[model samples]
Target: MAARRADLRSALPGLRRTLRYLRPHLRPERWLLAGGFGCLLAEVAFRLIEPWPLKYVIDAVIEPGAADRSGIVALLLLCAVALVAAAGLRALSAYLMTVCFALAGTRAMTAVRADVFAHVQRLSLRFHGSTKTGDLLTRLVGDVGRLQEVAVTAALPLLGNVVALLGMTAVMVVLDWRLALIVVAAFPVFVLASSRSSRKITSAARLQRRREGELAGTAGETLGAITVVQAYSLERILQRVFGADNQRALRDGVKASRLAAGLERKTDLLVGVATAAVLLVGGTRVLDGALTPGELVVFVSYLKGAFKPMRDLAKYTGRLAKAAASGERIVDLLETVPDITDAPHARPAPRFRGELRFEQVDLDYGTGERALRDVSLRIPAGCRVGLVGPSGSGKSTLAALVLRLYDPTGGAVTIDGHDLRDLTLASVRGQVAVVLQESVLFATSVRENIRYGRPDATDAEVEAAARVAHADEFVRRLEYGYDTVLGERGTGLSGGQRQRVAVARAVLRDARIVVLDEAATGLDRESSAAVRDAIRALTRGRTTLVISHVPEEVADCDVVVRLEAGRVVEYRPRALPRRGETVDARRR
Candidate 1:
C-alpha cells in the first residue's frame, strides 16, 4: 500500500503539468463553468425540494382525514413544479458542462501537439537519425489522441462527479444519518476496487501504448520503404515481426480490458447490495414510525443518486488508465533535455570568410567505434574542396561536421576564426546548405518545393533559382509549369529531375557555404554534366565541400582530400601528371 501510494505521489507532478496545458481554456471559460455550477446548485436545490412535495401530498391530501379536493390539487401542482425545475436544471447543467469540457479538451490537444512538434524540431539530428520516423509519428498522433480522449471522457467528468458525490453524500447524511451510514460503509469498497484496478490496468496500458508506438513505427518505415523490402524480398520477415508486435499489444489490451470489466461488474454488484441494505433498514425505520413513507422514498432516491457517480466512476476507470499511459509518454518526451541546445550567450556568427578548418578533430558515437580520428584540414574561402574515400572512411562524417549535424567528440571545427560550437547553431546552419544523394521533396507543387528553401521567396526568385539549377526548361514543359503538383518524395519526377529540383532548393537558399554529398549520384552522363554545371554556377564565390567517389568530379575540384581508416591520408592541389610521366609514380 505504501509503495503504491509513493508511486502515485511521484506521478503527481506529471499530472499537474498535463493539467497546466488546459490553463488557457480554463481562464477564458470561467463564466461558462460558473454557469454550469449554478445549474448544478439549482438541480441539487430542486432535488431537496422534490421530497417535500411527496411529504406534503401524502400528509395533507391522502394520509390525513382532511383529504380536501382543493388541497390535493395544490399538492399535485407543487409536485409538478418541482419535477419541471429539476428537469430544466439537469438539462442546463449537462449542456454547459459538455461545452466547457469540450473547449478545455481541445485546448489541451492543441498544446500537446504543438509541444511535441517543437520539441522534435529542436532535438539533435543524431536523435532523429537514430529514432524511427513512425515512432515519432505515433507520439504526435496516436498518443496525443489518447490524451484528448482522457480529457474529454475521464478528467472533466471525474471532477464534476467528485463534487456532486460529496455534496449528495452530505445532504443524505443531514436528511437521515442512519441511512447515510449504509452508503458510507459500502463506499470504501468501491474506492478500493477502483484504485487497485486502476493501478494494474494503467501499468498494462502504458506498456501496450509503447508497443503500439513501435508497431506504428515499423509499419510506417516498411510502407515508406516498400521498394527496398520488395527488392530485398524481406516482406515475409517483416510481416512476422509486425505480427509479433500486434500479438503482444493484443494480449496487453485484453488483460487491461478484463481487469477494468471486473472492476465495473464489482462496482455494480456493490451498488445493488447497498440499495438492498438501505431499503431493509429504512423500511424498519418507517415501520417504527421514526420516518414517514414519503421520506423513505426520498432517501432511497438520494442513495440511488449518490451511487450514480460511483457507477460512472467505474466507466471512467478504463479511460483514465488509457490517459495515464498517454500522460506518461508525453511527459517523458517533454521533459527530455535535448543533447544539443543554444548556448546561454550564443551570438550570430560574423559573415563567414569561408575559411573552414578542422583542428585534429576526433569523433565517437559512444558505441566503441570511432567515426573520425585526429582529422585535420583547412580550405580557404571560394575554394572547391573535394573529399574522397572508400565506404566507412569518414567521408560522410566529415561533411556532417561541416553542417554541424553532430559536434566533434574532441577538438574544434572553425569557420573563419570562430569555433563552430561557440556560434549560435541556427546562425551557422542558416548560412550552410546541404544537398544529399537522395533529396526529399513533399507531395506539393514544384514552386512550393523550391519555396521550402526560402518561404518568403517571390515567384521571380524561385524561377531564377530553377534556371540556375538547369531545371527551368523541363519545369516549363510540365502541365502547370512550376505549379504542377509532385508526388510524395518527388515520386513522379525522374531521378536527375528530382536531383535538379533539390539543387534548385539549395540554390534558392543562396547560403555562403554548401555541402554536396554524392549530389549527382543518380544522374546519367548528360544530366550529370548539367547538374555539375549547375553546381559550379551555385558554388562560385561560396565555400563548397563535395564528397565524391568518382574521378571526374574530384578532378574538377581545386583541392582533393582523401580519407582512409578514419584519418586523412592526403590533402593536395590536383594537377595533371607531367608529359611522359606516369601518374602511378606520383602516388608512391
Candidate 2:
C-alpha cells in the first residue's frame, strides 16, 4: 500500500511521454474528443440520478401519513416517469460517446498507419536488409490496429465507468460519511492487488507480442520461398520449426491471461467483502434510529455502483496491458531515425551533366568485409564504361553510389563537381535510370508497367519506348496488346520478354545516366542480340555503366575496368570512334 504512490509517480511520466508522442494525431480530433467527454459527463449525471427513483419509491411506501391518496398516486407516477427518463438519457449519452470516440480513434490510427508505411519505405536499404518484412507488416497493420480497437472499446468505456464511480462516490459521501469511508477504505486493498499484477501482466504481454512477431516472420519467410523449400524437400522440417515457435507464443499468451484472471478474482472477492460490511453497518444504523429506510436503500445502491470501476479495472487490465505493449512497439518503429536523410541545407539538384567521379572511395558494410577499397575513377559525360570482375567484386555497390543508394564510408562520389550527398535524393535518383537482372512487375497492364518509368507518360510515348526496346512487336501480339495485365512478378512473360519490358521502362525514363546491371545476363542468343540492339539505342549519347561478364558486350564500351578483391586491377581507355561510325561497325 505504501508503494502505491511511488508506483503512480513513476507511471505518470511514461503516460505523459505517450501523450506527447500522440499529440500530432490527437490534436486534429480535439472537437470530437470534446463531444465525447460532454456525453460522458451527461451519462455520469444520469447514472447518479438513476438510484434516486428507487429510493423515493421505497420511502413513499414506508413513510406513514406522508401525503393524501391523490397526492401519493401523482408522486408515484412522477417517480416512475423520472426513473424511465433517466435511464433513457443515460443510454443515449453512452451511445453518442462511443460513436464520437470511435470515429476519432479510427481516423487517428489510419493516419498513423500511412505515416509508418511512408517512413518505412523511405528508410535505407541497410535497414530493410536486416529487418524481417513480416515483422514490419505486423507493426504497421496489426499492432496499430490493435491500439485503435482498445481505445474505442476498452479504454474509452473504462474512462466513462471511472467517471460514474467518482460521481456515485460523491453522492454516497453526502448520504452518510461513515458508509462512504467504509467503501473508500477498500480502495487501498484493491490498489495493492492491482499494482503488483500490472507490471507482471505488462511484461508478459510484451513478451507475447515479440513472440507473435517472430511467428509471423517465420511463416512469411517460409511461404515466400516455397519453391526453394519444395526443391530441397524441407517442408516438414520448416513446419516443425514454425510449430515450436507457435507453441511458445501460445504459452506466453496464456501466462498473461492467467495473471489477469488472478487479479480480477481478487478484486471480485474484495468487492463482495466491502458490500457485506456496508450492508451490516448500514442496517444496524437504521435499527438504532440513525437512518431512514429510503436512505439505507440509496446507500446500498451506491455501494454497488461505486464498486463497478474496481470490477472493470479487473476486467480491462490485461487487455489494456497488451494494447500498451502494441503501442510501445509502434512508437519504437516510428522513432527509428533513418540512416540517410538530406542535410538541413540541402537543395534539389540541378540537371546532371553525367560526369561522374569516384574519389578514393571506401565502403565497409558494417560487417568485417570491405565492399570497396580506396577506389578512384573518372568517366566523362556520354562515355560508356564496362565493369567486370568475379562475383562480390563490388560492381553493383559502385553503381549504387552514383544513385546515392548508399554513401561511402570514407570518401565522396560526385557528379559535375558536386558531392552526391549535397543534393536531394529525389533529384539524384530522378536523373538516373536502372535496369536490373530480375526486374519486378506488378499485376497490372503492360501499358501501366511501362508507364511506371514515367507516371505521366502518354500512350504514344509508352509505345515509342517499347519500340526502341524491341518489345513493341511481341507486346502487340499479346491478346490485350498494351492493355494485357501481367501476373505478379511478370509470371506470364518469358525471361527475354520481361527483360525487354524493363529496357522499355528505362527508355521511357530518358535519364542522363543509365546502369544496366547484367540486364541481358540470362537471355538466349536471339534474345540477347535483340536486347543488345535495344541497349545500343538506350545508351546512345548517355553516360552508361554496364556490369556484365560477356566479352562482346565489354568490347562495345569506350573503356574497360576490372576489379580484383574490391580494388581496381585494370583501367584501359579505348580511342573514340570515327565520325558517323556505329558501335557495330567498329566491332566488325
Candidate 3:
C-alpha cells in the first residue's frame, strides 16, 4: 500500500487540471449556461434599477404640490410596483439558474465518476494489491462530492457575483461622480486584502480536504475489518487511534473556518469604510449644491448594492478553495493511467484450445527480488497440471502469468501460440477462470452469488453448477432455497458452504482454462473432497493449473511442477516428454 500511495502522490498535478474537467460540462449546456448568464444579467439589472425609485420618491413625490400631485402619486405607486416586480423576477431568475446549473453539473459529475471507476478497473492487479479499498472508496465518493460542491456553489455564484458587481458600480458612478470616486478608491484595498486572505485559505483548505479523505478512509478500513479488530481484542486501541484522527480533522476544519470568517469580516469592514467615506463627501456636496440630496441618497443605495457582491465574493472564496481542493483529488484519480493497458492493435482471442506456454518467462515485482527466473513450462490442451511449492516460491506467480495478471519482466507468455501481450486483456482473461483460496461473495441472494461467474447463465445452468459443487443440497434446505440472502461477503454461510459456492462459480465459468490458487488449503477433508470432485468435473476438457501442497491431490495430475525460491526445481512424469519439457527444470 505504501508503494501505491507513492505512485498516486507522484501523479498529482496543479489546479489547471481541475478547471479542464469543468469545461466539457460547460460546453454541452451552452444554451442553458447562456440562460443562466442572462438570468444573472437580469438580476444585476434589477439590483441597479432598485435605487431609481428611491431617487424619484425623494426628489419628486416627497416635495409634492410643486407639480400635479395626482400624477406624482401615480408615478410613485408605479415605481413601488416596479420594485416589487424586480424582486420577484430576480428570485425567478435565481431558480432558473439553479436548475440549469444543477442539471449540467450533475451530468458532468456522472461522467467524471464513470471515468474514474473505469480507470481504476483497468489498473494492474499489482496496484490494487498494494492499495487500500477504503482509500480508493474515499476518492470515489468523498472527493467527487467535493467537486459537485464546487460546481453548484462556487463556480456558478462567482460568475453571477462578478457581473452584479460591475452592473452596480456602473449605476453608482452615473448617480454622482464625486461619491463614486470616494467609494471606488477602497476597491484596490479590498481586493488586496481578499487576495492575501484567500491564498492562506486556499492553502489551508487543500490540506484540510486531504485530512478529511484520510479520516474517511481510516474509518472505512476499520469498520470493514471489524472482525479482525474483535478477534485480536484491539477494539479499544483502534477506537483511540480513530478518535485522534477525527480530532486532528476537527482542528484543521476549525482553522479553515476561522480564516474564512476573518476574510468575510474584513471585506465587510472595508465596504463599511467606503460607504462612510462616500456619505461624508457626498453630504458636503449636497450642502454646497454640487449634488442634490435625492441623488446622494440614490448613489449611497447603489454603493450598498455594489458592495453586496464584493462581500459575497469574499465569503464564497473560502468555499471555492475547499471545492477546488476536492476537484484536484477527483481529477487526480481520473487521470491515473492504468499500469496495464491493452495494446492498440490487440484483438480478441477466438476458439481457445487451452494450450499454455511460458517461454523463458522472467517475472518480478519492482523490488529486486525475483519471483520467476527464466522458467519455462507448458500445459498441453485439455491437461491438468499441479504446481507445488513452498511459500514465496513462484506457484501463484506462475498462475497469475497464465492469465497475464502481471506481465513478465522479461520473456514471453503465450496461449495457443499467440503472445499474451498481443491479445486483448479481456480476451485472454475471459479464456481463463480462477477460484481463489478465500471465498469472496457479495451481499446478495444465493442464486445471484452462484451466477456471479456467468451473469448470463440461466437458472437451470446455475442450479446444475451448484449441484456439481455439492452446494445444492444445503441451499435447498434453507427457507428461501436459492433465493436466500447472503449477508456481507456471504457471512451468513459456513466456511465450507462459502467454499462450495466458489466452486459452483468456477463450474459456471465454463472457460477453456481454470486456475485454483490454494483451492482446498483450509477445507475439512470431507469438504475438500467435495470441492475436488467439482474441480475434476469442471477441468475435464480444460487446461488446469492447481496450486496446492497436498501431495495426494498432486499425484492425480499428469504433470507436477515444483518451485523453490522463485525457480522451477523439478517436473514429474518426464517420460511423457513433450519436446521442450526439460526447459521447465533448467530455468533458474
Best by lDDT, which number? 2
Estimate the overall C-alpha local distance difference test score of candidate 1: 0.78
**Cα lDDT, model 3, residue 262:** 94
Worst 10 residues of 2 by lDDT: 579-588
- Write one digit per residue (lDDT tens) for candidate 3, span 562-582: 999878888885345343433
| TM-score per candidate | 0.91, 0.93, 0.92
Which number leads on TM-score? 2
lDDT of 3: 0.78
In TM-score terms, candidate 2 sits at: 0.93
* TM-score of candidate 1 versus the correct structure, residues matched by position: 0.91
Write one digit per residue (lDDT tens) for candidate 2, span 1-588.
232332233233434555567779988999999999999999999988988888887888778787676877888899999999999999999999999999988988988899899999888888888988888988999888888887887878878877877788888888889989999899888887778787787788888989998888999899878889999999999999999999999999999899889988998899899989989999998888788888888888888888777777677767777777788888888888887789887789998878888888899878888899988887777888898899899899999999888899988899988898999988889899999888778899999999999999999999999999999999999999999999988879998898889889999999999999998888899988888888889989998999987767788888888887788888766766334322211110
Which 10-residue span in candidate 1 carries the lowest summed lDDT? Answer: 579-588
Q: Rate the local accuracy (lDDT) of all candidates.
A: 0.78, 0.85, 0.78
Model 1, residue 408: distance off in Å is 1.4
